[model samples]
Target chain A: MEYMIKNKNEQLTNWVNEYSDKLYSWAFYKTSKKEVAEDLVQETFLSAFKSFDNFKFESQPQTWLFKILNNKIIDYYRLLARNIEQVTDDEFLSKKTTDALFNNSGQWVSAPINSQWEEQEHLLDNVDFTTVLTNCIKKLPQNWRIAIESKYQEEKKATDICKELDITSSNYWQMIHRAKLQLKICIEKNWIIK
Target chain B: MRFFKLSCKKATEMVEKEKINGLSFIDKLRLKLHLSVCKACRGYEKQSTLIDDFFLKTSASDIDNIKIEENPKLKETIINRLDNES
Candidate 1:
């Protein structure tokens, strides 16, 4: 029993050495906060260690570790949203104003802002532009960042995200809407218009 | 009354909704009707789709190369915590 336990410890230590930096990088990107990111990465390793037996080895260790880390990030985002919810009654008022993308008579309040994305796909080849987008995404409010990341980056379903985050469907959609709008404006101002 | 038709606000919301969930047949028709007359909303729809595509492409491997600054002691701290738990 001691030998088996020792072997498991050895393997876990190797995993910590091999994957911790990559996992921490991904978490830090998602959270944009150093301490929070570190804590999430630590929680991910601890969880992975606890569930070592359940890991059937069908997937790469990196994949399994990332899956656990993604859940931790999602839970962290949900916690942030919950805490933010407690202090912001105007959240609903702000949501209603998200519709202000258009005017009272149903016309766009301004010209279409997304006009210059013709070279956007090519921007993917430009590493600096990609970093700019990441920075822009990180600037979003926590819940909006969570909504956008889960929907587009993580490719999760609306129902699943809503349930996991304990958010109403209406609020989820609002967050996505607000996130995309803000991202478009930010990218346009910082990248395209620049 | 123009009450039955989709407004620009409603049309854009439907466009975002279509990204998350499929639009209903009537909602689709409403969106189509709105898009037919509104060039800006069409621009919004196209851009929204582009943003989704950008996100997917970005996620494919962005972290592989990001040089995130690391705390040298974090791994040891985590392993120590795990050992304590066990």
Candidate 2:
């Protein structure tokens, strides 16, 4: 009995060392905050340890751990949404920026059509594109980042996101629209234009 | 043009919202009409959705760059706590 328990503890420790970095990276990708990611990773480990005996080993240990961390990310986002306050105005993006993109007659101000981005479909395989995307996501205001990441990456339902973020339907739609606009413009300037 | 008079701004918002939630029939009609006349808004819609498609397709990949290092003491703290509990 003593020997079996000792081996179990040893295996758990090994998991901590092996999976910690992968788990941290995933958590950071979801949260985009180092401290929150670290905390979630720690929480995941601790929870796994407590429930260690219940794990059936049907799935790979890494898969099991990832499942727990994914749950943690969702819970974090849900909590954030519940606690977030509604914004009174368009705080970060300005009307002038929107105007520059569209004219008084609701037409494109500059060239009506952008250069055909032939390579866009292949950008997924490009590490630099992902890096640029990550940087652009990071550049957004915290709420915008939260909104975009939750909506796009997590693929949460609009109503659920609105409930979590304490925003109305109109507010939710507007945020997503504005955030995507900014992201599109940012990518065009950095990746396509240059 | 009045019935189908969706401005570029409103048309773009509808385009973005259409990805997650279905757009209203009138809004959809307006967007289609606007896109028919407005090449820039059309380009914006296509490119904006492409950005979304890029994220959805690539998010599943093993692209790791923003690495977060756990505090060295975290393991020790967890182990100690578990020990105390047991």
Instruction: Give the alpha carbon lDDT tens digit for every residue of A76-135 in model 2.
Output: 876765544544244335334545776777655565233444335666567787777777
Model 1 regions more than 4 Å off: A56-59, A81-101, A112-135, A157-166, A187-194, B1-3
At residue A82, give the lDDT of candidate 2. 50
The residue-by-residue lDDT of candidate 1 on A117-168, one tens digit each, is 5334566667776676778777776556666776643557655656666666
Docking outcome class, model 2: acceptable
DockQ of each: 0.57, 0.48
Against the true structure, candidate 2 has what lDDT? 0.70
lDDT for A160 (candidate 2): 60
Docking class of 1: medium
Write one digit per residue (lDDT tens) for candidate 2, span B1-86.
Answer: 67778877888888877765678888888888889988767877877766676666656655355555655666666566556645
